[model samples]
Each structure stands twice: as structure tokens, then as C-alpha cells.
Target chain A: MNKHKITGFQYFTVFFFLLNSFIPFLGFHKITMISNQDALFSIIIGSILMIGFTFLIKRLYFYLPNKTLFEKIKFLFPKGFFFILGILFLLSSCILLFVTQEFTSFIHFYLLPEVHQFLITLPFLLLIFYFLRKEQEVIFRTSEICFYFYILFFIISMFGILPQSNFLKIKPLFSTSISSILRSSLYFFLSFPLPLFLLLYFPKNSLKRKEGGQKTWIKSILFSGIFLFVTLFLILSSLGVQLTNLYKNPLMVTYQKISFLNILERVEATLSFSYVLLYFFPMVLLIYLLKELILYAFSLSPNYEDLVLLLLLIGNLLGNQFFSFHTNFYFSISIFLAVFLIFLSFYSFLKKE
Target chain B: MKKTKLLFIFTLLLLFTGCSSYTELNKLGIVSLLGIDYKDEEYHLYINVVEGEQDDGSLQKEYITYDATGESIDEALHFLYLKSNKKIYLSHMDVLVLSEDVINSKLQEIINYLLNHPEIRNNFELVELSSPMNILFEEKIDSKEISDLIQMNQEYMGTSFSVTFEHFLEDILIDKNSYLPLISFDKNLEINGISLLKNLKILDTLSTEETVLFNLLQNNINQAIYKNTTIVKNETNIEIKKNQITFHLKTEINKNSNKFKENLQKDLRKILIYYQDQDYDLLKLKYKMKQNHLSSLEDSNVLFPKTSLKFDIKISYTNSYLERRISK
Candidate 1:
């Protein structure tokens, strides 16, 4: 009885928003800041795979009609299956913590490096927590408010990054194999828009089988592909493949190199702030997923999203010291495990279907 | 439940207040620009302290130079702090200026200090002050803030490059060598510098031209206006065309093991030449002449134009459109 209509532009904008989650966090899109990792090459190819896999995932979901992907896992596998998957998702949250910390540290160093780093992150985390405590309507409204600025940023990032790009270095594009690209795509998918799909908590029935519903997924993926290309191209052109590899933070160097005249330089603040607004959407989604997982596991449907925020506050503090980013991408969940997750989706859905 | 939640909120507020505010923005005294020079076995610290300078609205910042000596930069800074009216914080410090004495005598200590500071953001513009450190502080750059103008040099114009604090970390941490954009002030008090640092260690500065060449070779060409690109056809007037490169890398053949030996080298060379379209005189021929080490070729042909040169040259009217295409 209701339609949430999103245009091609909205679809494209959402893709940028999805990638934006990766951008603001310091190490998530580390390819742009430092291109040395074997994982860096994946940005280009991974983007393509993410697009391809989205379609396949959707088709697979159709076959297991009645259940959400997570539920299918609980039905199909033994008792501990969903719990293990929940832990994997928790690891993803840890990686996100590293990324957010890295980014905030970067912003503090660039914009107000003299201020205690804790001061910088404190404001951000507090703001994020305050929103997390609120209702979904407020969060969605906030995303709507921020999305306008995100579009403006995407346009500016393209222009700002374009002139500085060196097309020549785009050579040897396939320096990394197709496998590397797929791995990078997995990195994007594990923590991003896919995880955000846990927002299916509404009383409304299944996502419509209509074309528009399918477009939501397809359009977002396409938008991400274009974003990935631009980011890779910008980093490659600005830092050069060699030097880009050397710097731990390549985007910082790229921004340093960007000068309109001479007066308007050292804009790391503008970049970091813009990204904060953008990353908030996914931050909302992150908390939302945590809430859904706990609720679905116990079947306590009494609206505990706010309570989830409180848990995150404690978890967020403990998580600060839980893991170091050195292990971020070096350790990936295995292929067999990934397949098991896919299987869980099928079984969880079978009973419901 | 409401009473318990209120108590928890009150406790959190107490905990926050109990902890020290990490670093105070103004009281900590953000060192927006830093100048270090070795003077008479003593180290001098010149701080472009960014603050509301005077009652006058015209000048917004007061750049102060503090001179002190010790076994370490921190010690010297401590001595300077005792003399100064405010605290000296180097976290927001953007431009690190090394006087010729410090840079020449070896910048190992200064570089080490910067590397260790947690607050310094690594990618900062390492500059060389032409007129002694004191003179640099004296020059009134027309701007609201001294730091503001310093950024203008790098941000608005391709004139000066900044080696950010983070960039310094990258270069210093790298295995091989690192390069940084150098900053220099003219007699008229204008500042400029773009040079490379090899492995985060060096006093050697590349001229602006050499920096351009290095950028081109590395393919970091954001914008380039070659002074005079002279085609060596007849050594007359040379019309400049687009110059670009594509890279081809081998699978790191180990020479010690000597697996393919001759065949690999030959195969790799063929790939490189083929990828670049070596038949083109501008691309391969120029590189060849350089390889043969022609002394005459070193001469600037485009500027003097009348020098007789015997070399095959080609030019095609590829529109200079990198910037144009990006804009559209």
C-alpha cells in the first residue's frame, strides 16, 4: 500500500554514501591513502565483483523466499551456526572501530592536532551515541539531511580529484590479479551496505518483488562501482603508484598536493568533516544491525534498539583496546566459512518460505 | 529505572570532568609553524605562534622566534618556554623550517624529534629559510594569519609544495629514499620550494625544474607547463606536444639464480619498448640519446633555438587536454 520511490540520482547518491562509509574511516579505504597492500589492487576489481555478487545474492534470496538471509542460517545449520556468524559480524565491527579511530586521529592531527586526540573522538562518539539512542525516524531524517551534503561532496571530490589525477599511472591497471579484486570486494561487502540490510525490522511485508525493489540493490551496486573507480583513479594519479604505496595515508598526501592557488590548502578538516556526516548513515546501520542480531536470537521483540545503543557504548570502549588495525585485512574469514554463511541463509529461509 | 539512569549519567559526567582535557587548543599554544637552526653550538626554535596578535585588526598573527640550546630539541624548547610568555605546542605545526646550518650539519636529530612526536601529522612542508631564521620571522606576509599565507603557497598555486607531517612518516619509514617539497623565501620575502628527500634523510634540494622532471618521470603530472620543450629535429623552434608514459614490470627475475638470464632481459626490454611504442622519436629516441650520454643534448634547445643538433625527432599535434577533459 506504500511506495518508497528513489530515482536514478538517489540510487547513484546512495552508492556514494555506501562507499563514503569506507572513505571516512582511516584504514577501510586505505588504498587511497596507501596503495602498497596486496589488498589495494582489489579496489578496482573488487568493485566489479561486488556489483556482480549483488545480483547473484538477490537471485539466491529469491529461491529461499520466506526468510531473511540471517534467519535461513539458523534453520539450516546446527545450534551454534548463527552465534559463530554473529561473532564474525562482531569482528567486522572491530575493523570498523579501527577505521573510525584511524580517521578521527587523522582529523585531530590535521585540523586540531594540538588538541588531545581523545577530545576529537569524544565529540564524534558522543554525537554518534546520542543519535543511536534516538528513533529510526530521526536517524532516517538525519541521513536525508546529510545525503544532500554527500551529493555536493561527491561532485566536489570528483572535480577536486580529477585535475590532480595523472592518467599515465592508470597503466598496468591489472597489476593485481582478478582474485585480488574479488577479495577487496568482499572487504567492502562484509561491513557495508549488506550488513545495513538488517533494517528489515519493519512490520511491512517482504521487500516487494517488483522492479523498483530490485533496482534498489542493483542501482546501489552500480553507484559503488563508479565510486570505486574514481577513488582508485584519484589515488593512483595523485600519489602515483610508487609513492602511493610508500605513504600510510595517501589521500592526505593527495589533498596536500591539491592547490587551487596557494591560499586554499590544508583542507583535511573539510574532508574529514564531510566524511563524518556521510559515515553516520552506516553508523546508524551498524547499531541497527547489533540490535537486530540480539533481538532475533532471543526473540525479544519489545523494541530494544535503544538498549542496543547502551550496549554499544560499553562495547565501543572495550573494543578500543580489543584489536589493533595491524590485523585488519591480514586476516580474512575463510571461503568455506563464507559458503556456510550463504547456506545458513537458505536454511533459515526454508522454514519461513 | 529513571532514577538509576539519572545516577549513571551523573557518574559519567563526573568521570569526564575528572580526566584532564588532553591538550588545550589555545593554552597549549599550537605551533602552526616551526623554525630550527643550529647557532653557535646551540639550537634555535622559531615558532610562528598563531594567535590574535595585537589590538590592531590589520595583523592577525605574531610570528615569534625563540632561541635556546640544549642536547635535544625538547631541552632547547624548554629553555625557550621559560623565556616566552606562553606554552609551546608543536602538534598543529605545519611547516618545519630547517636553517641551512641545521640542514647542512645533518638533520638527523630534528628529523628524529618530528618522527617521535605523536601530535605531528607526518605530512608537513619541510622548508629551507633563505634569509636566516630570524629574518624569516620578520617578513610580514600580507595575510590575516601567518599560517594562512603559508598554506596559500601550496593550496592555490603550483608554486610551493607541502610535505605534510604524515608524508614525512611515510618517507622516513620507507626502505629506500624519500622526497619532500622544499620551501624558500626570496629577497622580496616571497617563499617557495619543491624538492625531493631521499629516504626521509637529506639536505640536497632539487631545483624546481628537476622536481618537475621527477614528477613527470614518476607520472604525478597534475599540471605541467614545460618552459620550452624543444624538438631536436633541426634544433630550431620546438613545438611542444603531450608527453606521457606507461609502465611495464617484469616478474622480478633473480639475477643471482640466473634462470632465464639472457632471454628474460631481452624479453623484458622488448615488452617495455613495445608498451611505450618506442618507434616514436619523442618517447624512445630522447631516452636513447640520454642513454648514449650525449653532452650536446644536455643543452637547452628550445630557449637558444639556433644550436645545430643531429637527431631524429617527431611531433604530433596531440591537444594538451588533461585538464580540459577533467573539467568537462
Candidate 2:
């Protein structure tokens, strides 16, 4: 077995990489679905729910050290049930593939309307392939380096859009029904890092201490909590609810609102290019996790991981052609996977006790 | 090592090779101001551009206007692009001018086209002209100059506030209505007043005097000097025969401050009464009422002319002039 030990800093950096991957498109739209007034409230509730899931995943890690969730599933389930576990893992990977497809389609239509979808996704798949070839530490290092660029661009774009926010646009609190707010929270839970347990394959030896994983989890929640809340607030205040829905990518629209002296225009193109910086490592990491999970599921040799990587790359390239993003389909798949993982974790703990 | 270098070079090349249909700057016809007019059952688009050239080692700017007619504003813009020297770029467009006819009838169509166009910016100021197409080729005054004139006119003169396309969209979305500053060009261009819009149709056009009162009623007086000769506080009344009254000016009477407040209230009420018959609430008081959750003005209810709305002007005056007089 290969050792994939990473220090606390690298772990936290990769955690942020995971957290921000959901942000570029999914998280922004989900909050707006709740309504403009309730977007802020939904974000707080969503953060708490995600944090609780992270803590649960951390507790699971403690229950079975140095083991992936799939390995725990095999131990908890009866003999020959590993095949069922493998199918579940494959379905989870498909969800991640669906996300990459959505991201690819967004870039294809919104960013490069003239470019073909295949051409737009090619570079992303290639980058992921390269990362898959490298050691897991390489991804952690890349994420650490990319984190600086993310924060810098975040600050720059926030400053540019600071003055454009009209707080009056956010309607009074509780304007939306409780059911709608809860539904938005559920959509948020399914879309964001709550479902990121698919990639919770960190080796126990990688942690410097027993509690290192939980610390990273808390730090990521704190950092990403502030980041998401501020971003949602800025979007709601700047575009309002109706106009926010009017644009497919409200972040780019928010970037377009930035007028430096009102002459240096089209800053959205330059600023939003930085989103590639934020998303590239996370994209590669998702693909890498998928590769590892597939190899482990089929009980293949580590050398055959490259073959899985190629297959997944080809899968992503053709994924959007075959499948389209439906909110109901995505929400159902996410809820099923989330419940399955939770049940597996609970069963494992009871069996051990 | 050789393979690594080759891969690195290939990746670097891919990064620089952006996927865009590249067009040279010279091949692009940059639209500085866009004018839309509806006449004869057709939409007309006027592209106002400042075509500058480096002739004899000096920069020379020439104003050129292009006109295209179509069934709709979008089609008309495409037609205008087809007849242009280069591909029309609307990113640099700072001003949008609509004919009164176009605004009165086709405002929604124009707004939808502008919003849907990823190229057209939201910060561009919108103004309605009586002759929108003629202003395109009006000579000497380029688009940038006209935009600056309107912006300055709003900032200092205080007749009407400049409404950006973004703010106009926001106002429409929030209040279900909005207002745009109106400009008229006879010999020279001047801001005539503001046009009140109720869901893209022009409800009414307020004249310059009415716009001034509108600005005062809204309390958006950035720095406009309003001159009126009357003072009616609680105890005293002084009526001066002056036409220009600046609100920021210090009235030198602690005792007569109430009287001044009364006079200002009386004048504001008089202006409100004058506009009451029009059924247009320029102050957006109903919106305020909705915000406070007052059930009198329901969210679905449109304020009528006979709603009997009252204006309680809270005059906050830090009277240093009166304080100094008392010290003396």
C-alpha cells in the first residue's frame, strides 16, 4: 500500500479546495431559490448542517482508522455484500461526474459560448489526468498553492463589488414560507460538501494526531462559512432575487458590476478567469478520488488506477452529452447517497460496540 | 526529462490559446452611444460612434452615425451592425437614448434586448429624447460628451437624478415602475424633466419645475439650490420675495425656525396637491408603507390619485447661524 501522509496545513488546504468546489455554480443558485430575504438565513442553516456532517464523518474516521468508508462498508456488511457497496460507490462517483458535467456545460455556454462542449472539457480532464498520475501529496501541495490565489481574487472581486450592494433589495426577514426555506436548505445540503464524503478516503497515518481531522473540518467550516455567507449576501444585495435568476452565473454578473473609473470595462472576463484557478485543483481531486474508489471497488492493482483514470476522463467528456442537470434527479441521487453513507456509518459503529 | 519539457511546453501553449472568436480592434465598430426610435410601425437603431484617426501625426476625432430599421430593436441593432464598417461593440456604450414614441410604447422590448445582450453594460445612463435618431448625427457633440453633460446636469443642477440601466431594472423589479430623466435637443441638448414609467409604458412626463419638486419630495437633493421666498414657523411668518432658495443655507433665526419649517411644509404640501390629480406618487411613499408592513397600502394595491396620502416633512436643521447670533 502507498502512504499518502499530509501535514495539518496541507489537509486544511485540501479541505478548502473541496468546500469551494461546490460554490462556483451550485451553492449560489440554491440559496437564491429560497428567496432573496431568506438566502442569508438559509446560508446559516446550511453551514450548520454541513458542519454537523463533517463532524459525523470525523467521528466515523475515528471509529475505523487508516480505512476508507468503502473498506468500513465491507467490514460492516455480510460476505459478498461488497459488490453492492461497489455499486453504491460507483453511483456516488457518477454524482461527482454529473457535477463536473454541470461545471463544464456552464463554462461552455456562459464563458465560451462559441466553443464546443468537448473542447471546453478537454483541458479540465487532461489536468485531472495529470494530477491522477502524481502522488496524492502533489494534489495537496497544488491546493495549498491555489488557496492563496483564491483568497487574493476573492478580496479583489469583493472590493470591486462592495459599493454596488443595496441592502434595501433584501426584503424583510421571513418573507418566504418555512417549507420553502427548509427545501432550499435541503438542496444546499445535497449540493455542497455534505456529499463530499465520497472523497473521505484520507489514510489514518496521514494525520499528525488523532484529532487532526476534526480540527481541519472545523477550520474549513469557519473559513468557508464566512466566505459563502458574504458571497450570498453580496449577490442578493447587488442583483436582487429576480435579476439574480435572470443571469445563469450571478458571480460573473456581480463581477460585471465592478466599474473601476467606469472606463476599464469587461473586468468580469479577467476576474472570472480566476475562478479556473479556484476550481482546477478541486476538479483534479474529484477525479483522483473517483479513480481510487473504482480501483478499490474492483480490487484491482494500483498500476491499473491509470486505466480507471482514463475511463473516467472519457466518461466526463461524454457525460453531459448523455445526461443533463435536473434539480429533482440531482437532489434524489444526493439524498439517497447521503442516507446510505450515514446508515453504513451507523451500522459499523453499532457492530463494533 | 525531454518528455517532461515537451509536456510542459504543450500545457503552456494551451493556456495562452484562449477559445474566443478573435476580432482585431480595427475591425470592431465601437458604439459609444446607442439610440432607439419607433416610428412608422418600425424600430430604428442609431449607432453613434466617434471615429478617430491618426492623420499627419495628430489624433483627429470625427463623429459618425449609422441608422438601421427593423421590426424590433434587437433586429434593428443587428441590421445596423450589418451596415457598419466593423462589428458593433456595445461594451463601451455609455448612454442609451430612446425616442419619446419608443419609450411610450416599446420600452419593455428595448429593456429586454438591453438586459439580454451580454455585451451591453448595466451602468449606462438612460435618457429619452423627443428626436432620438436625430441626436445621433447632431454634429460636434459626441456620445461621451453628451453622457458627461447629462451626468453633470443631474449632479449639480438637481433638476432630476440620472438613472443607470441597473438602477432602472432594479426599480422596475422592486416598485413595478420607475422614472428616467428626459432630455430635449432644440439648438443644444438640455434635460427637460423626468418620465414616470409604469411597467415600461410612459405614465406621464414631468416638466423641469415638477421634476425639481419631485426631487425635493424624494429628499434626493444632492446639491441643488431651491430658492423660494416664504417662512411660516409655528409662531412667526416671514415671506421674502426671493425665487432661489437653497436648502443647505443657514436661516439666521432660532425663534423663527419653526416658522421656516411651516413655510417649507406649506410649499411641499402645495406641490403635492398640484400633483395629486395626476395620481403619480413621485415620493414612493406607498413603497415605504409596504416596507413598514402598514396594511393600509397593500402590496398589490396601486396608489390612486385620491388616496389622501399625507406628507410629514421632518426638517432636521443644525442651526449654527442662530447659535452664533444668540452668543453675540
- Top of the candidates by TM-score: 2
Cα lDDT tens digits, model 1, A1-353, are 12233233433344456555555442344553222333445554555665565544453445444554456555455577577657757754765566556655666555555556555555555566666555544555555567777667656666676776767555434444456556565665544433324332221124333422345655665666566556656776665555665555566556655555566765655755565665555555555556656767767754665676677755765566555565344235323334544554345455544
Can you write out model 2's per-residue Cα lDDT over A1-28, one digit (the tens) per residue?
Answer: 4454566777777776666655663657
Query: Whole-model lDDT, candidate 2?
Result: 0.67
Number of the top lDDT candidate: 2
In candidate 1, what are the lDDT values of residues B105-189, reduced to their tens digit?
Answer: 6577776677556556554566666566766666633223334544564343334455555445534443224455555555454
Measured against the true two-chain complex, the DockQ scores of the candidates, in the order shown, are: 0.08, 0.25
TM-score of the A-chain for all models: 0.73, 0.90
* Each model's total of backbone clashes: 38, 6
